[model samples]
Target chain A: MPAKQTLTFPYSRRPALGRRRFLQGSAAVVAGLAAANCRQNLAGPPAGSGGSDGTLHIYTWANYTDDSLAAAFTELTGIPVVVDIFDSNEVMLTRLQAGGGDAYSIIYPSDYMVSEMIDLDLLTELDQSRITGLDNLKAQWQNPAYDPNNAHSVPFCWGTTGLLFNREATPGAPADWDFLWENQDELSRRITMLDDMRETLGATLKSLGYSYNSSDPEEIQAAYNRLLELRPHIAAFKTTGFENELLGGDLSVSMAYSSDAIALTLEDDRMEYIIPASGASLWTDTLAIPATAPNVDAAYQWINFMLDPEIASAAVERLFFATANQAAFDQLPADIQNNEDLYPSEAVLANSEGIVAVDTASTDLFDQLWTKVTSA
Target chain B: MTPAPSPPRPWADRFATRRWLGPVVLLGPAGVWLLLLLVLPTLLILEISLVPGLRLGQPSGGYGLGNYLQILQPVYLRVIGRSLAFAVGSTVLCLLMGFPVAYWLALMSPQRWRNLLLVGFILPLWTSSLLRAYAWAAILRPSGVLNTMLTTLGLPAQNWLNTPTAVFIGLTYSFLPYMVLILYASLEKLDTRLLEAAADLGATPSQGFWQVTVPQTLPGIAAGCLLVFISTLGDFVVPTLLGGASSMNISRLIYNQFLGPTRAWGFGSALSMVLILAVSLAIALLLRYGDKSSVSET
Candidate 1:
């Protein structure tokens, strides 16, 4: 019989090649691309893109930027600007903290996040001498409590969080937080609170006749208990997921930020938003340069560009967000000025408070209570 | 029957001394891989579990059992329990649906079409899992594809998305193919002569199936169950999207603890350890039972 042979042992070495080597090489290439992409994002605007100094990158909310505004800025100042949108203050803060946002010359952080960022030393103090049109802002925002004297941040936009509901779904528009509590029986599985802890918990605190920035542990616990009481009726704790349901008529009410509610109300007549009778958290999103910002000159220019009344007014009309620039507000169309959602009545304004970061003890208490509420 | 003829002397001489090297060479890379990615990360999580209240970017104070103790809190326990319920429910659901299809594919399907049917079953897995979850959302929502179809069929519309039932459905749908694939692999090797012999011995069709076919496929069933169970237990997406308000499973809680307002890395690490332990126990049970079933089948 002819000798029969079988391949055996170490498979003859065969140059030790495998498909995995190709995968490793491909992975290295992908990782290199990702790092370069991240670097471009973190190192400031791309080369030769803006005003001969490169485009200014402004990290902001989705509704804050419009194409025409960017196009106009490019035509006027020659400094092309790019906007990156984030859904929440915390997510933006996380990106900044993780060194992912060093490229941005400007970032929009809400009032309390501004305070937190300042404490963390992430923001650069503005050179007031170079900044133009500082006096064009609304009086309240001129020296806001969150960034007093405007030392670190410029109040770019201001709005209040409130209840947005489908008026056709229920008999009347939701007027207050207590309406949810009183009608928990009827509203079971039909409502959603913001996924945000501070906004949701703070609203609950305000509903129970407490301050939005209450530092008292007892008040925090009371708010926790109140939220627990309402959890059975709550369909979900969501920030952006409620939009589809609310628009589809499956959700009757959702706690929403004013910018989002205003846009939605404009889309449908049946949808309306109201500041609760007891009050809600008013938020001011501010533009500030990070300390690690690579292009300080570009940051200043971006700020001055936003402060321009024509630009700000056009943004307000296109974006549907209320602006902190008083000069711009004056230029807005009469219909926009009269829009109640953008500018609520004084009685509603009186009850609103800007969210502020409480002391560590209170924050801890809030965390504990949030856990219990969600777990239950 | 005569034992299979031994290999010729020259071939036997070559392999007899080198058989050990074959397994070692073939398995070394994967073993190293398992150690680095799986075993090392698990150990790191175990170490982190010992530190209490350890937030990321903060200096670690010391090592203790405080983080593990926190898991005993009623709130956290409820989350863990809910996770188990979802995983177990989905595993059973997948098994119930997967087994019959695997049986038909392996034992009954035409030989030429068998591979094609399997490719079809596996095609859904090629797309991103996130896209699948979103597709389920569109289909399961109140005014969604499923409800629209139901209304057209004169059936009542179902509101299943963002509910526990939705979570179960999503998980079962996501993992059913893996169960079927594993069972089919085991079942294709089944001996048909034994089944025919049982039937010839005056055994009824039902008895022949139970006594012959089932015993032959026990190993496949065990393997399929374990694969489905382990995958469902570690899943993070379905429970987050489909599990509406208050579906605070251990995985989501751990995520929130790290990334959300709390930023308690210690508690998150502790929860990670618990999840790792639960998955390990399931794997251990599978190895034992699955090995026994395979041996009995042989």
Candidate 2:
């Protein structure tokens, strides 16, 4: 969900901002290439001018903001905003951890990363009293798994990790995660999983009747071995770059986020996004202020700006992500509300697990196995 | 690098007494820039490499060789081995393909069109390397332009994208121009008289090329190969874009450590040091052989 941005061109297109920028070995250099286009979009006064000088710097996924969104916020608040995009939550977190994120007054991290930031004390505690429209949030987001009671982060966009396949290209419609393994011969070198480690590994874990956040070494090892079997058949691990191939029927299937997949299916009739019958990982990208945020006042204003139901609904209409704000959802057109992929049913939601920060040992295990899997 | 001797003047003679002053005045800005940007950052990475199990956003601990030692693990060794293989393979491919075109452009082709031909050869470099790799991706995918063309010609289609074969093609394509430019520079100065001299001495064309042409251009060949080797060795775009899952070389490995799921800065720094060392080793060889070959020829 953190990587829901279509603008990510993968260099797997820009880390989808970290890949080609590693020469410096510092997180600062990992600024997404999207910043080149984003620079011109920055409006009003110079950023980091301090003291509510009508400047707000936001670091977020590319899908979240458009020029109009920035213009709208500035029109209402009179604060010109600068938007910088990050492809992955890890890249976002790394930049902040490396002290390169002080300029950003606001950042959008995915659900699991919200919890991670909270644990690290990197995020400021949200001021519930100052924020209006807090009650408009859906019941689930009110006390979400990643950030309990929405204490530190605001739920912005939500989606699930699932297979997006070409109906004509695949031998059969994939009903679940196990479909790929079962149909390896037909799907060989034609399937692209997410470049994301957790989503792919977690999906595999769920297929084997294990939790998406399985921490047990044995369960993880089993998942690794299973992934190894499917790896040869896997064409590439990509988040943003597979769209053209999949649409062209060169790729049979791709593991993708609902936001990206939903957009594709809307344009191309051949593409279909499905949640695995076994289960899938549910992800929520959120808005949070870094503890070291320079402009607290403008940050609050921006959060409140997004919280407004009218603004929120408009974002959903244009951006195509499911609205977390119930007021916004109620205001959305009937067609959008009825879109099953955008808003999946309750039973499907119940089966899905939110990824969490696993213990260090488990993380190390995942990294080791992932390295070996890719290398071998 | 030698500084020019200044015209002796009354005011300048005082400062000129300090002989080291001339070099400092000449190299001061660039030297300071290199020290700050390159040398210092590399040393910092070196220091971080010595700290075992150092994760980002964590406090530093006592340093050890654990990170470097961890790189000795077979999994990492295979990655290093893969990177080396890609580098060596690309260098050879470039040399094989570049030498001929360079020979023609430098010596055999129409003299007036030589510069234009060289420009045309290097035109691909003007576009972003990322864009070039992406273009290759578009061309090499299963149903991409390459296969389309092959099928049109009544040839078997190839699905080289996302394979090691694709990586080699992409790397060779990206680096070939550099090889050509350097080889051309060397081949341009090929004293035709030497070839004539060899021919007059009962050497066949092949013998003349092997004995005189190659030896004369040995320095450029070494320099170009080293340049290609270094560039391909550190390349992140081609391998990541075209190499697919198996192309986890040292650069990608370092990328994964720093920006990937694991923020193992320590291990990433270790990998960086190793890559740096490998490139430095290439440069060292270039210095050793690039100069020595020219010297031996002269």
Candidate 3:
């Protein structure tokens, strides 16, 4: 099993050499990549695991794993943990596909990415008996579309993308996605949507009464056109750069993830987060073992460790993520439990849709349309 | 000749076989470096680019020119064109802004303060380019420093951020120092005697500058422009930060293809190849035309 999981380094063969020479060449390539800052932090686990030979490497979002969490796991199970952080699901998947995921046993990818990973046969099926806290997950998460019945991934956190605005700058509150369109005159060059192609286009699609994952060419093009109409009003397509402008009152509105918006809103009362009336893309970040994972036993142990309700609760509170574990949510402080941004009421969530993988042709069209929109 | 060689052929013939050693030693390391890093990667990219829509883990399909063909689409071509415009515009702007300052520093400024002036010009560059771009945002935004100053002066404030002009300004500002440094190096070597000769021959100062000084600094100008152009062509940060929602360029497009949702490594590689080719062409032109003295006068 571990043999199958070993990365097929892109440059595995050499015309001048045999198998041993090939391994050395590949090793050198990995070393060179590490030197170039491509995948250095991915090696989170210390060498000589258990003071011996087993190491469980986890690739996850930044701030997902801390030293205390690693120490706790090490102390509890005598199996050490090494965590490497990635900024985005796409980046994590890209590295995994590029064959840099050999040492990593566990990875965290967002909901849609989990579907893509499953399609690519990158994930290992989890044994339900081995996981202790499956029952503790909310009913909706247990049967999530991304990973039905928790077949391959464990849902860690879920959130929606919506508006993050400055209350002081905008005399009145922004109530929905249409608010930006309505105020395009005033908000011109003072509003930024997300940098994500799917989310930004999806938001436009949702506003126009289309599915976030619409495969229809007409619908996708319509979304693109709508975005182009608002192009002059948009300040920038930024991922994380809107913080200062929003705070400084230079920006009136920005589309943001609930996690980021919630974090920022907590810092200042003048900032407000709103889940649009129509809807937005709902995303979940999840953890799964890769099919190519070495040390299966360590991987199982790590999963079980994360499944403990107390540990899950701690992660939810400390990490500031919306917990999928119902038991953990019950344990959270009242203020956090009632945080509307994290756990919006069902009426608000009804309009939301999960982004799914589109067909190949549709995916290409989306890329082409996105290029046209941005480059226009 | 054979008769003469017959006397001491043993050690001489054996030792003479060592002459090829120097070239091999001199070029070996760099040859291997280029082969592994540059040549091999480019070949790999070519192979990947041939397989249209090839994601990393998926089995690669039969090869074709699909990826290259995709770039020919008007949308992508526009992106490439915009990137070229930005690069070329920035190069011209840098030359315009830098030449005068370089001229002053190298020719007119007091000798004792020359080094200090050059250091001051480069001080902002010593920090991260990202920081500088951010600083420009603060100064150029609608409610930013420039606008506030304009309003205070009862002048119409300019809405500059998130515009093409902002991108050009940022690119020019970011690359101006590199242009200045290169021009200064070339200009410092100016022949003052030649200028005096032209002036003595009844040429006015302007004519002297055009005839004597300008030609001398032509090489430096060419070198500076090429450097600025090549650097700006590859710059994603400044344009992405300063250019509004619609301002996608080749670098950002390439970035989206690679790291963005599409993950189309093939298309991304094709774009990369084009950028590399463009920069290579500019450098070739620079090498072909740049002269040591001609870089000083302007």
Ranking by TM-score: 2, 3, 1
lDDT of 2 at A303: 96
lDDT of each: 0.78, 0.82, 0.79
Q: List the TM-score for candidate 1's chain B.
A: 0.85
Model 3: per-residue lDDT, tens digit, A300-372?
A: 7887777777887787676667888898888888999999988999998999998888888888888778767
Decide which is better by lDDT, 1 or 3. 3
Model 1 sits at a Cα RMSD from the real structure of: 13.7
Best by DockQ: 2
Task: Say which docking band candidate 1 falls in.
Answer: incorrect
Q: Which runs of model 3 end up more than 4 angstroms from their true locations? A: A1-56, A66-82, A294-301, B1-17, B59-61, B292-298
**Candidate 2's residue-wise lDDT over B1-298, tens digit each?**
8999977697667766667688888899999988886888788889989998787666767899988888899988999999999999999999999999999999989989888999999999899887788788888887777776677689997878889899999999999988898888888778999999999999999999999999989888998898899999998888888988867888888877776776788888999999989999988998887734432332
Ranking by DockQ: 2, 3, 1
The C-alpha local distance difference test score for the whole of candidate 3 amounts to 0.79
Clashing pairs in 2: A9-A13, A10-A13, A11-A14, A14-A17, A15-A18
Q: Which has the greatest lDDT?
A: 2
- In candidate 1, the residue pairs with backbone N, CA or C atoms under 3 Å apart (3 or more residues apart, or in different chains) clash, namely A42-A103, A50-A54, A50-A55
